[model samples]
Structure formats: C-alpha cells, structure tokens
Target chain A: MYRQDEVKEASFFDTGEGLVFSYGPQHPGTGHFRLIVRVIGDTVLSAEPDPGFVHRGEEKLCEYKTWITNIPHLERPAILDAAGMLYPYCLAVEKLMGVEPPLRARYIRPIVAELNRIGSHFYYFALYGVFLGLTTPFMWAFGDREFVVDLVQFIGGQRITHSYFVPGGVRNDVPKRVPSGLVKQFRAWYRDATGRSPSSDELTDDFQKYVLRVMEFLDARLDHYWDLMLNNALFMDRTVNVGKLTAEEAAKLGVVGVTLRATGIKRDVRIDEPYDAYGEFKFDVPVRTEGDSYARAVVAFEEMRQSIRIITQAVEGLPDGPVKNKQHPVNIRVPAGEAIARAEAAHGESVYYVRSDGTDRPYRVRMLTASFRNLIVIPYLSRGAKLAEIPAIYWSQNVWPVEWDR
Target chain B: MSESKIGYIVNELKQALGESIKEVKIDKKMTKITVEKDALVRAASVLKGLGFDHVKGVTGIDLIALKPPEDSFEVMYHAGSYSVQELANIIVTIATRIPRNNPEVPSLTSIWPSCEYHERETYEMFGIIFSGHPNLKRLLLPEWWSDAPPLRKDYRPPGR
Candidate 1:
C-alpha cells in the first residue's frame, strides 16, 4: 500500500544478533533476477524483489508488430509454459473478432496446452529439486522434460518459444505419431524411475548419494551453492514459520497457482472456466489450507499429479481431426470490439485483454500475468520472515520474474 | 441478461450521463462506451452503479492516424462485474479522447484501488496524466528514463 517514492532508506538490516546479507542479480542461486533482502540475527526481516532488469518492453513492442508476430514475443515471458501464456491472447483476439475456432482446433489446442503444462510443471519440479538440495530429482525431472520438448519441437519446430496458437486455431496439427509416442515414452520413463517403491533404507541411501554427488558438483563449480544451503538445520529453522500467508491473506491479495492453492482455494482457471476442451476432461484442483512454504510445495506436487492426470485423459480422448482451422489466413479480420481471456498458467491465472478495431493488429493489448499479481503479496508476506529463509520463500512462491516485468 | 436487457443497460448509462457519453456501441463481442475526456469519472461512477465493480484493465493506445485536431490520445477503462458471473460478465469499456498536448483525465483510483497500478502504467507508457491520482509516479519505467512515452507512435527506440 505504500508508494514507491514515499519509501526511503533501502539498506540491509542486522537485528543486533548477526550480519544481514543481500543476494541477487549477480547470485547464481537467485534465478535470472535480483532481490534485496533485510536480515537480522540470521532471520529475514523484509525482502524486495527488483524486477524489470530483463524487461524488453514486450507489451509496447506488441503495439507495432503484426498480430501474428507478437505470438513469439509473448512466449518469451514464460517460455516453459508457452502455450498457457499465449492461449489467452489467442482467445482474446478470437473473441474480439467473433471467430469461433473449429471444434477440432479447440481440442488440439488443449492437447498441446496440457503437454506444455506437463513440461512446465516438470521444469518447475526440477528447479524446485535443485533449490531443495536434491540433485537426482532435478536431473530426472529435467531429463524427462526433454521428452516433452522433443514433442514440442516435432509439432512447432521450436523447443521453448512455440508460437503455435494463433487467433482462430493452432498454427498446425499435432504430429500424428508424437502424441501416442510421447505417452508411451512418459509411461516407460515413470515406470522405470519411480515404479517400484523403494524401502526406507534404499530411499535414505539414494538421498545420501545424491547429496554427496551434488555437493561435489557444486563444490567444484559454485562454492556459494552447497548441500547445506537449503538443508542446513538453521536454514530450516529460519524458513519453517516465516512468510506465513494464511488462506485469508492469500485470497485477499488475489494470489493464485501454488500460492492460492496452498491456501486451500480449489480454484484453477482451467478447471473452473473450462476453456479449450477442459470441460470434457476429468481432473481435481489441489488445495492446501496451511498456506505456508511447505503447503505451497505440497500444492505444486499435488497439482503436478493432477496435471499428469489431465494429460492422460486428453491423450485418451485425443480426437482425430485437423488441429488448425482451415479458414484462409488473410481473410481473417476481427470485428471491432474487445475481449478478455484467462487461463491457468503454471504461475497462476494469466489474463489477456485484447481490443480489436477490425484490423489485423490489435488496437490495445493488456496482459495481467499471474506473477505480477502475486508480486503484491511479497511485501505483505516478507513482513516477519527471517532473512535466511528468503530464497526458500521465494522459490516456494514459484514466481517467474520475466512474466512479472513483462 | 438478454440482448435487449444489455441494450437497456447501455441506454440507461447514456441517460445517466448526457453529453458525457460520447459514443455507445454494442457489438457481438462486447459493449463499448466512449465518454468525453472530462466526464470519465462520472461515466465510471454511473457504470459502477450498473454493477461494474472490477476494473479489469486500464488500457491506452496510440492513434496518431485517428487523432483529431484538438485531441490526439485515447484511453479506455474496461470494467465488469464478477458477482453476476454469466449474465453480468459483460465488460463496458469507457473510452475517451484527450488532447495530446496536455493529455489528462480524472483518475479512477479513488473508485477502484486496483486501477492504481494500471493507471500508473498507462502514464508511464502513454504519457497521459491521471489528474488527482494519489500516486502518479512511473510503475514500469525507470526513475531516470529519458525516452518519450514508449508506447507512442513517434517514440522510436535508439537502434530501432
């Protein structure tokens, strides 16, 4: 609620117990962004994330580019979840133009969207594993992600920035063999990886082996990132109860995705709104009422499971039809109007508002990304959290800074 | 609400604000209303009474080609109601044209607090001042940015 200009005295705090530290922009573990943290007595007092270091003026850039050209630009915000980011923009444009995508196209859109969701969630799980001091899980998650990326490359000719979703339908149909092939590959991979449940001893041994190997790797490359980073007893002590955003506080701030689901709000725009063939699929929206860092992590894990279920159902009901609408490309002229489209991105509910003046280009394009909305909760949540726990809290929130700054 | 009901809502909004309601267009996609520059606050007030509580987004577009002699800027306030859900999900965008020389419009932040950031963004990108806004500083632009409004048609980036 405080104005940026009114806030003064930006400095790290040491609460007479210990030295306060600042980690960001230059820190490898801090992701591709910067944040200033205030710590006192090995506990974080406040943390302010400084975004926009990578802002490329995408929104303003969209104004000049053709409607078709902006698709690639939009995907850069959250490349891992490209479909979820761009589908809403396509929907908004289609809505403004009064053009209904063919039924076949709608079904295909969701299929690709679910595939992207799986890829994105896997990537998140991989990053989360790395953040939580687990290396094997990170390698496993990322290695599995390559399978989905292969599918995307086969379908869209690009791994990360897939500009497949256009105004009326997808850019092209899903490759005939890729869907079944990927499903089989994923099943095999999962079966071979987590199939046989390990005993407690085996699990402990695996954990220790991963810790040692990861420690060696980190020790050789990045000294700052040690096995003790997130696993240290003091680290857990610092993060356990800090940044506690109850369900009420989370809802009040309109936090979404893992942040809101962590608070036990059974709301997923895909399930609730049921856009792009989601209505026919069966899935559950994960919810945890605790609204803590652990709760957020649990929610993300549960949601990943739910997303896997959705992908399974989508593959099972994969209808045989042309994925792209057959209409002539140049003949498409959206009627003069406006439309708002929302989709459940990996971060949260990402909304796109498109205003069309019956032209090939949009008159106005406004995107309310989930990270931007979730960023508001940082100031509120960081009020009492210890400094040492800042990274854990931030990672648990699952924020993508590019999406916020964009 | 039926199409007729939506029409009635638009007509009622027009009646509430006489000359302020410059243009009212109801299309298949959305219902749009353009108010006079000075009447934006009143138009927003009237729309709120009609059940548009949430300000979905405050969008601005550069219309150099469509600029009139007196006004060269256009701004829109898109608002809707989530309570009514289906029947009332219709968004009514109140657009207004302001003089490019001194583009200024009454801030709706007093009415919709969420519009605070959105308006600040518009001010940063379009250089449209939202008079009476509680905090009018730039939201996305750096404090030392010297570039013209980035979203404007004539403001070209250095290399571009």
Candidate 2:
C-alpha cells in the first residue's frame, strides 16, 4: 500500500532500517486508525497499531452530563449497535440506583439489541466484502441491513443512533402499530424488487407479525451470504490459513467476539452473566475450531442466525406490562457505589465500570470496549504475515476504531 | 453456585496475599480485591495461578474529587478467566492506591501479556507510570501532548 517515492520523501524512512509502512489513518479499511508496519521485503516483522485518531474523551464528558443524557453521547461510539453499547451502562446505573426494569422492558431490550446485532453484522459483512475487493456483497449487505435497521427504528423511533435504552427501562414501548408510512415503503420496495404486489399479511402494521416477517427474510438471506462471501473460493483462499490464532494465544491476548469464538472458546458475556432477557432466551454461542480469518467470518455469520433466533424467541415470549419503572426519575441521584456490567456487543464483550457518588452525575465511568480489548491482537497477529494479508487479519478481529478510541 | 465460586477465589486471594490483602468486596456481580502497592505483582501471580488468565480492563480513579481530598489515585486491574468456567462470570478487580505526587506501579504485562495495552492506556490517561512496562510511551494521546493527564480530577478541559 506504500508507494516508492512517498517512502523516499518521508522522514521516518530516512532512519536506517527496514521499510516502515504506515497503513492508514485515512485508508478505507483502517477507518480512523493507523498501523505502522515494519517489514523486511514482503514479510511483516512487526506491526505497531496507532489508534486514537478519533478519541472524544467520552469518559471525561460523562462526568459533566446527567445520567440520562449521557445515553445519547455514550451510544455514539458504536452507533451501528446503539442498544448494545448502552446496555451495560444502563445496567450499571440501574444497579447503582437499585431499580429493575419491568419484565416487558427486559424482553424489549434484547429484541432491539438482536435487531441491532443483525444490522451491525451486515455492516461488518458489507465492509468485509469491500476489504476483500468484492463489491457485490457490499451492496447486498448494506441494502439488506436496512430491513434490520427499520425493525430497530420501529421499536426505538430513530434509525441508527437510537437513544432508546435508559436507566430504569427503555425510552418508550414497542409500537402497538407500525407506522403506515413504513408499511407502504416496505410494500412499494417488495413490489419493485420482486415484480409482484406483496401480500397484506407480509406488510401488516401489527408489530409482532411485521418484525417476524423481517427476521424470517434475514434468516433466509444468510444462505446467500454464506454462498457469496463465506464459502467463496477467493475469500477462502485469502483468509483460511492467514493470521491463524490458537485458543491458547487468543486467551493470552484476551481477544473476544468472533476472534475468540473462532478458536473454539465458548466465552460470551450474555451466556456467562445472563443479563436482561438473555437468560430467558435460548441461543447458541457459535464457535469454530479453526482460528483463522475464514473461521472468524463463519462465526460472525453464524451469530447472525443465532441473533435472529433470539429475537424471535424474545418477540414470542414478550409479556405485556409497563415498560418503564416510574419510580426512578430523569434526574435521580444514584446512591454512592461502584458497579461493573458487561454486555455482548456486536464486536465482542463491552464492560462498563461506573462509580457514582450519590449525585446526579457519575463520578467516573470506565468503558472497556470490545475493540480496545482486541486491539492487542493487531500487533500480535500481523507479525510473520504477508503485508497484503494485513487488512484481512485486521478486519477479521472486528476492531471498530471509534468504539476503541472513546 | 457462582457465589461459592467467588467466595473460593476470594479465600484463595486472602490466603495467598495474607497481610498484603487490604480489602475484599465480594458480591454476585464482581469481586474486588485491594492489595498493597508493592505486592501487586505477587497478587497478579496468585490470580493467574487461580485461573484468571487475562486482564479485562485497567482503570484509574482520582480520589481527590471526594469531599475531603484523599490525595491519592487508585488503579484497578479488572481480571477475568477463560480456562476456568466457574470463574468466567466473575470480574476480580485487583486494586492498589498510589500517591498523587508520585504515582508508580509495577507493570503486570510480564504476568499477563494482555495487560500490555491496558497498562499503556492507564499510563497516558491518568499519568500513573507502569515502571517495568515494555513500552510506556503515549498510546491514545498524541505524541505532542504537553498538558496534565486529561482524566485527572484537577486537569479540567479548557473552557470548562
């Protein structure tokens, strides 16, 4: 990725050493992160990851904002999976305040979370396709992800940055009726794409019927994803043995999500701790024995199927009741205590350690994102691999730059 | 069942560290173990031996913000397990206090290689030096950063 003349004019290149190539704080693959790769010929000797190009000092800002208001700001780092990002924070705050969200809210939390998970995985596949130079999957993935995002918006009112989860419960209940506009839009799209008018049952305004249809559609789409990206000859050849990580190495480095799951370790926070409705829902934590780029993609793709299963279970099992606990007010001061909560975000396990001083604002909030935990593996795995395979290994770990930077 | 597991780990920690163990807070959610500053590495070794194979997060809290200033910084290492299934759900926070004037602690990267990046981020965020860190230079912060650690209680962001 480095040009000859560009290397010649660079000051760091003047130092007597092997070729030290800085691969993007600007490149499409890196996305606001840089990797300084010191390579001898085509083999990478060591790859030093340079992160924090998008650091927003979110922890510092948390102290200033009220607990409720912080929800909007905290969800920004991993906007694609907004509900997942805020899940732990909301849990921690609720723990400190000593209030539990009602049963209905608990069910809704996971339903929306799995929707975001599906959306986020599609986004990953979209970008992963581009990184592997397959544009067809990119277009197909982003286009497919809209359906999942639409389901989330039906619940949370907004598309991407849904500040839906709060301390005691969600901001609002799932709509009793899906908006007529959304129904017409889906109807029109179905008619245009399939060249036939959709059935009234498929485009019904009933929340349960409509969301289930979307999930069924996405569940069927996973087969095409497997065919297009996961099982493709080029994808398999490029990623199969590239950046192999043993289970021992993965545990030692403390990587999570598909990266750890690919190594055959069944370590998921949702199953381990069983927060919220995760305890009620029965879903498999997908695993693959071969710890390679290909295995990671397979694990991620498999997770989408499991997410759909969880969402279906949640929707079917959702009990009718109050969504929010009215006792906890908007500006409620939390009792002085420290609590740590963990959630299985799309990237991996995101942990939030919150310390409250019996004040409206938090004394300190430490967010350990999944991407930050996996950042260690970038430098570790990139060693001894061909320079061209860097993107495959990097994106395989699912290191979202902004999520880690915050 | 999980509570007893946490109790077992807490007992092991207390027995291993003995006089060095300052406080142990055990709950269903987390088990926080505070140890002496000098005995940090020994505590980490005991934890690793107890099957806490990796560090989850390294957090620094400035206690000066409290009503009567404590004038010290608390660094906590949130450790978890993958090999030990019973201990997998637990987060054992091994914490120690360092003087605000001269905050220094031995790096635990030698014990748990996963602490490498966490320690580096802690160093830059709170200016707590990890003495034996392989690379203790700036991580998240820019190379040209010349201000007090932004996370410190006294170091307010400009225009605040």
Candidate 3:
C-alpha cells in the first residue's frame, strides 16, 4: 500500500518576490497543459507556457509513414476537427502530385469539412462553458455537437480521425440517401447561391438531403444557444473585457481563426485562399471588434451559424462526379515538390508544409497548427491579467494543447 | 506572362539583394527564398517591410548523415501576412543554410516578435542556437532531457 505520509504538500502562504506557481499539467480546466506563472498576489507577473506533455514526435514519425498512412497520423493531433487538420495535407499532396480532385469530391469535401468545423467549435464551446462553471452550457453543447458527429460517421465511416481524406480527394464517396428529384432542386438552389456551381450530373444522392435536415436542426439550436449561454448576463460579465487583445496584437502574433476574427481582422483561409468547395460556396466572414474574451466567444458562436450556412449550401448544391481523382488511395506516389497549404480550421488556420521526394514517404512534414502559432500570446495576455480570468481567455482562443504540443 | 506574384517577389528579392539571395524557388502558392546566413537579418527585415510580418514557424532541418562528417543544416522561416490582403495570399519561406558543425544564425525575433517561441523551438529541436534571442530555453522537451536534438536526421532514439 502507498504511504500517505510520504506525499509532499504545497504551501500557498509561503509568498516572496513573485511566488512561482504551477497552474496545471493535469487539471480539468487545462487538459494536459501547464503554466509556470510567477505571480505577485492575485495578478500574474509572468506566464511561461510549458507545453509538449503530449508530444508524440508527429513530425519525425511522418517521415516514415506513406503519404496515405500519414493522414491518420497527422489527424490524431487534432481529434476534434479531423477534416480541418487533414484537408491541408491532402491539398498539398495533391498539388505535389499535380492531379485535381473531381468536382463531386470538391463539393462533398466542404460538407464534411464544415460539419467538422461546427463540431470543433461546439467542443470548444462546451469546454468554455465548463471552464466558466456553467454546467448547463457544457451539457447542451456536447449533446448538440453529437448530431454532427453522427452525420460525419454516416458519410465518413468513422467519427474520429476519419482518415477519409486521400491525396487526390476523399477516400470514400457519400452514401446514397436522397431521391433524384429533390437533389435536382437542391442543385438548382446551390447553383443560384454560388453562381459557378459545376454540373454534378452524377445525380444528387441521399446524404445531401439528410445533412440538410441536420443543418436545419443546428440552425434552430444556435438561437437556443444564444438564449441559454450567450445572452446570460453573468457569462457576459466574466468575458466582456477580460484578456483584451488589439487587432495589431493579433496580426503581429500570427493569430488566426476565431481569435483573429474577434479582433476585427477579416482573415479566413477559406475565403482568402479557397480550397475544396470554399471557392464554390458564398458565405460572409463574421467579424467582431471587441477583441475580448466575450468577443471571441461571440465570434465562435457566429462562425457555427456560418458553417451551418456553408453546409446547407453545399448539400443543396450537391453536384455529381467522383469524390476522388484517379489516384490510388493507399499507394499514392507524389512527385518531388514542396507546398505550403492552409485551411480555416475551427480554432484557426491549420498550415502544413510537405516536401515530397517522389516516393510514398515525404522528406519533411511541418504542421504549423493554429494552436502552435497561438502559443506566443499566453505570456502577453497572462502577464498582468487576474489569475481567475486566464481560463476564460485561454478557452476563448479555442486552442487545443494536444494540437499545440504536436 | 509577365510574372506570377511569386516570380514578381523573387525578382524584387534578387534585385534588392545583390549576392546575398543564394537561390529562390517558387512553388504553387509558396515561394522559397534562400539567402546567405549572414544576410538573413536584412532579408527578414526586407520581407517584413514588404508586409510579411508574422513568422509562422522556424524549422531546423539537419542534413548531416550518421557519424557526422558532413553537410549543412537548413533553417526555414515560414512568413505570411495578415494585414496586407494581397500579400496574405502568398506564403514566403525564407530558407537559409548554415554549416552543420557551426549551426548558428542571427535571430529574427528583433524584426518579428512572433519568432521568439519558434526560435526557441528551433534552438531546442536541432541544437541550432539563435543569436540575440531574449529568452532561449527548452520548449517542448523536459528541462532535464539529455539527448541529442531529436528531430535531427542523424539523431537515434534509445534502443533504435
């Protein structure tokens, strides 16, 4: 039996010139993360983000795996939004191979991608809800997010780390679940919406209509989210002015995704550098200038709404064609080239730099994920802010330490 | 064709830097600008001046084979823009090569503050020291980790 007397105890009373405190390496609020903070009373003087607790040497290991096998490995770091993390990799590999994914694959890709985006945002929202001590929001967000999970599994064949994406296009086509007449109507609506919708003559299938229903359900859920969580005065007070970041600060710090959008910087990789159905979809890049914790939360909420719109448009505009190019899924051989590809992931921009050596294996794979890029701002924000507000600011950024450590 | 955005940038760089720009390769969406290590600071500054502000990541690639008689290491600085709408569409990777034996280069933290963490990462990952960095310490690895920089091509993990 382990001896209780052998355990060392920490004393909070023993304070001297900037007492060093360990925030977490293992705490519910902080999942596998630590902040070595030098604090003077309630305010933090300096915060050093000590990450890599979950470092599995993803980059080094990527050099060994085949281009096809690497998708699952790369997707593991970011479990919440597998498509967002994997999309850039597939795009870069495709670019290297000099083959274009077919039209149907392009349209279908965004449907799953947008659903993953919504899922990632909902996961963050649930965590934010818990971090703020509101159990109701946590439960609600988690439950609602599962609808997206179920939908993706229906099409993708796996709920997490789908590995559904290949170099040329998606690994599998969407399963048929819709009638030809309704799909035609949806296709017409989609063409009207985007103006350049390619003829998916292969016929719109069952999955498109099924996802449309899911989108409608989520659209209604967003209104309820506002009422239960966003509109609450207590929740608003905790986040309104906490951990304020200016637009300039966001720009200089390489901030992307929701955090950048919250600072009134209309930077979204989907629109700025469109990939896989984004160019075909018409949607507004939501921006809020508050540049505070509350603003980031609001931006995330609005982004979910926008993602719903994107999915709805994509499903309605379901085109017919192959979901993949004429490349082998498992035995893909990319030509020698290097490409930097980025996608608008839920948290931020997920960037991948792939250097292929005309083989199944890559020479190097560098994933400068949004969470990793956003690592610099922790010290900047936490330096003078109150300790209690750290969780709100940190969670609002939607940064996953697992992804950061990767 | 006159020049793509990438080619235009490469031409401007070649003109701006007489001999310091060692080589330049323009990929699809990204441009690889290789500069002499001594001129990295100036090149980074010029890129910053051209609206490539934030350093996305600083990666150290070791090309030296086993038993280290060897070649050179390349330090790639991934830079992109946010404020500059036109420039944001392009990713310019400034790759500078240094002798593997003396893997040292001037830090770009002075030009772009965002490179601080990345510089520290490069420092710890490949043992490539960055000169003039404010606080350069172990980032991902534990403080007591006593192994060769794990990402190096020649580095062999225990029992491998």
TM-scores for all candidates: the values are 0.77, 0.95, 0.90
- Where does the lowest 10-residue lDDT sum fall in candidate 1 chain A? A214-223
- A1-406, model 1: which lDDT tens digit per residue? 4444423222234334544455666643533566666655555555656666677788777766778878888988888889988988988887776677777777767766766776776666566656656566567667656766776687677997888888888887765444444443444443354444333332232322222222222223212222333344544554456567775555335566788777765667776556778888887888877777767766765665566566656655667766666666644666766677778787877878776666766767788887776766665566555554566677778778778678
- The fraction of correct interface contacts reproduced by each prediction comes to 0.17, 0.64, 0.64
Question: Each prediction's Cα lDDT score?
Answer: 0.67, 0.87, 0.80
Best TM-score among the predictions, by candidate number: 2
Task: For residues A334-385, write the lDDT of model 3, one tens digit per residue.
Answer: 8776888888877788888888767778878888888888877777777667
Backbone Cα, N, C clashes tallied per candidate: 5, 0, 5
TM-score of chain A of each: 0.81, 0.92, 0.89
Candidate 2 wrongly placed segments (more than 4 Å): A1-17, A184-199
Mind giving the per-residue lDDT tens digits that candidate 2 earns over B1-160?
A: 8788878888887888899989888864457889999889999998899999998989999999987679999999999988888888888899999999999999998888898888888899899999888888888898899999999999989988
Deviation in Å, model 2, residue A42 alpha carbon: 1.1
- Candidate 2 at A109: error in angstroms? 0.4
Candidate 3 residue pairs that clash: A177-A206, A178-A206, A186-A316, A200-A319, A200-A320
Candidate 1, number of clashes:
5
From the highest DockQ down, the ranking of the candidates is 2, 3, 1
Candidate with best lDDT: 2
- Span of 10 residues, lowest total lDDT, candidate 2 chain A: A1-10
